[model samples]
Target: MSQTRSSAVFGKRKEPHTIIIAHGDDIRHFTVRPWMAALCGSVLAAIAIGYLLATSYLVLRDDLIGATVARQARLQQAYEDRISALRTQVDRITSRQLLDQRLMESKVAELLDRQEELSERNGRMLPLLEKAAGASAGSADIPIPSAKPEVRADIAPANAYAASAVTNSAVAALARITKGSTAGKAGSASIADRADLMFLTINKSLREIESRQLEKIRTLTENAYKTADTIVAALESAGLEIDATYGSSDAGGPLVPVTGAESFDSEVEELDEALSKLDSVRDAATKMPIANPAPGRVVTSGFGVRRDPLIGKPAFHAGIDFRASIGLPVHATGTGTVSKAGWNGGYGRMVEIDHGDGLTTRFAHLSEIKVTEGQAIEVGQLLGLAGSSGRSTGPHIHYEIRRDDKPLNPVKFLKAGKAIGTLL
Candidate 1:
């Protein structure tokens, strides 16, 4: 086999190897060509390279695994940090929202309190306003505003839970709206802001109402004063001097100018004073026999100078003659005590009442006498029935007002009565 291998090696392009195996007396021979040898060598080389590479990998396996693990750990740490940052940002946003909500709630509560106060004030002024309206002769009635508060509680949430309970989609929508533009933020109003504005408006309206009330009271006071002055003038014109100390005693003090901002209390006080004065004047005027004795009766003959119905000649008439029907109900024109109730010559069935302040009223030609002598009588009280008794030519009444036993024209008193009746 050595000699055959040595001879085969001498050939170059025709290189071939023979393998001979001897065992006992049997021999086996195999031929190996160059291509076959090369194939086997390539196969062996591939197997050797695989073994070396596997060995190298096995030697540095710890480093490779360590690098892989380190890289994975770094990635995990980065992800954790990002998650923590996101969580912190969410916490900050939630805290800020909570703070803003608390502030808004406080503002809403304060506004509600103000609204309640204004409502109460309006309620208190309602009666006074109604009184002013009644006293006004011809004016629009002042209407009281509704007492109910205009602000609603649901406009602003009372607690943080209400805000927190909002869904994510709703929160996002709100954020979009709030952050849309700077102009939107400036121009738009929140629920709390709207509530505050309503309260302010209500307060302003209440102030205006109070001012109107003051003005009404002032007007009423002026009217009352004017009415009193007119009554006094009428009394003086009819030769009746009013007592200087009629209502309140004369008061003197430094004249303090009234300020522009008049209070309701102050205006109401002035009105009451004026009303008292008016009442006193009216009372004095009524006692002076200024009221008509027979209202709605036609005066057939006026007092002073008239042709006598019986004589048909010029005569000085002491009283006005009213053409009244027989048995017509007659009322006392003034409050006084009956001094005479029996028949008198030329004054048939006369009823006389002596009022204080030296004033007396006489009703003659009565069909029936109801009041007795010394009986108390008030204005508009039933005195007797009308009839053409003795002096009267027909069914008529002779109404006379006398001061200090001197006859005065009854037309003057009746005219004064008509003028003062409007105020009363």
Candidate 2:
């Protein structure tokens, strides 16, 4: 029977069951578990997350590297630009310094040239100064030393020294002129050498006393020039010829020489004699009248055309008449030698002065003549008394101005007198 049973038809096949293990307990349960599917899904998810994270990290790293490279490149470019700018500034400053140096050199050269020119000019002026000194001595009223002694002695050596000095100065000036543009140690040494030479030559002829005298002469000459300028200015103010007032013979005339070399030589000889005479004349004139003869008076008659005082008729008046009392003192116009002091035809009790330069003045119709012929009279000396001694109606002084024996307008001379008086 047992055999017939036949394995019980699958032998009660194990009930479709799952083993559940909970808390270490195993139990048979008719259920299905999906752990394998869930595990598979979890594995897939983990793989995806890992891929995303790797991609993000790689991208971030690449971006950072690119940014760093760009920043570095920009910084490098900025530094390069700054360096170029600084180089340009340095170049400009160097160029400016060079220009300034060149300008300074040019100015130095110009100054040296000017100094040389002045030295040459001074050399030319030395002879003139000596001549002026000689002339001044002769022009003085005091006696002067004779040149015979100095000339007879050996003055040639002094002349030679003077000539040598001048030559050396000229050479030094020329050297300075030539090398003024140079600016090195050699140039400096050359300049110093030239300066020393010039100093030595200048001091060779000039003693301490001579230097002082020269300085005084220079001051006096400057003062004389100023005086002459003042005189010219005053003449201009008075509407007179400036040259005429300055004692120019050919005032307002052309500078044409009369003759050729022969005439020029003769003229030169004549000029030398004239210059000697002029020195004496200047001395004499300095003692002549420089002020008014009569005070508190006015001119009643002017030189030139006027009606005759005795008769009402037109006549040429040769002199100006000043109204004054009979006892009024008549004064000399300038320092001079009295050429005539006596009664004349129309001018009773007259006084005449020879003031050189072909100029003369006459005071007529005086009460008494005080000066004698050939008497040296000083300026402002009493000459006579104003009176109507000649053909006059009243007491007055008749003054006359003559040049080369010809009568000129006394107005100009009188104005000159007034100017001189004011100055005094």
Candidate 3:
């Protein structure tokens, strides 16, 4: 009975650790220890705790990573926005710089065109001044001052100094911006502003130069016009008839088509024509016998119907006599070729000069004839010595002027010669 009681206690301990399993239409049984059951329950509980810890760790890690990524993205966007602002500033400044350059180029071209126009005006004015100078000198008694004066200007020098100042100022400003890199008012000024300021001053200088040049041109033109009119009046007073509006250009043949710069004005052309006409009239006047052959000499005999000096009766006198001593020097009265230089009927030692336009003069009753026949001679040339040789009662010279062998009034010519002496 005591052995049975001990087995029952052992079996009770075993029975607490026994395990059973039920299968389809079958039963299965297993034995276990109390410690094993406790170990299994502890393992399952540990696995559950480990799974919960792992899930919580994954959730916290994902949340931290998302927060970090969001912060980084915000920082990148801000950096991109800052870069975009800088890029926009640079692009705006560069565009303004290019626009300013184009404007500067256009201004320069306009100034150059004005300079060219001024040059053209100067060219046309020069000829008129020359014309006035020549006319006043030859025709007027007292010469006047000319308009051509030396000119000096300070545009270039002033511009150079000013440009240097502007450039230096701009450079200094730019250097400040670069070295300081300040976002201040001084640094905000851009290259375009500097360029505009510099060019504005330059343009003002150019305009000043142009204004002065224009004034010079106007003064020159007025002076030339006034002096030219004065010359024309003086020329007219000298007995030179000038067709004031005549142009020799039309007197020539067909003009060749010119293919060059047509810069000259009508005033210059008129001056040129006046100069040519003046030359022609001057040449003609010089060749004529407008000078006295014998100055301060008295007329001993008169031409036309008068008493002959030798025959002492009323007769036709073809020549006039000049009272002189023996061996007096005689001169030519006009420019011509000597037609005859020998003795003739009733006149000894004769000299006949054949002037142009059928005008002739006879110097007769001379002691000696110095010019040969057919020899060219000028007015006021010494011809021979005067003496009583033929048809003369005393030492005298017979002078006669004729046209185509017909006698003309010699007194008229002698008076004209004295009157025209001032001009020659």
Provide the TM-score for each candidate, comma-separated.
0.59, 0.39, 0.48
Per-residue lDDT for 242 in model 3? 38
lDDT of 3: 0.61
* Comparison by TM-score, 1 against 3, better one: 1
RMSD of each: 10.1, 20.9, 13.6
Tell me the whole-model lDDT of each prediction, alpha carbons only.
Answer: 0.68, 0.59, 0.61
Summing lDDT over every window of 10 consecutive residues in candidate 2, give the lowest-scoring window: 147-156
> How would you encode candidate 1's per-residue C-alpha lDDT over 204-316 as one tens digit per residue?
55455445545545666666676677777777676666676544566799977665334545766777777677667766776777777778889988888777777889999
Poorest 10 consecutive residues by lDDT, candidate 3: 149-158
lDDT of 2 by residue, 164-222 (tens): 45545555564554446345445445555565555455444443323333333333343
Q: Once superposed on the true structure, which residue ranges of model 1 sit more than 4 Å away at CA? A: 1-262, 271-288, 305-316
Error of 3 at 393 (Å): 2.7
Residue-wise C-alpha lDDT for candidate 3, range 1-424, written one tens digit per residue: 0112236455532244446788998977677767888999999999999999999988799898999999999999999999999998787766654555455455455545544544555555455445444444333333334644322222223333444454445445444434433333334355445545655765565455544444343333344344334434443453333345623234668776532133234334544555555555444554554445556779877889997656789999887788888788889887889999988867778899887777788888888889899999888898888877766678888888887798876776676555444334
User: Whose lDDT is higher: candidate 2's or candidate 3's?
Assistant: 3
TM-score of 1: 0.59
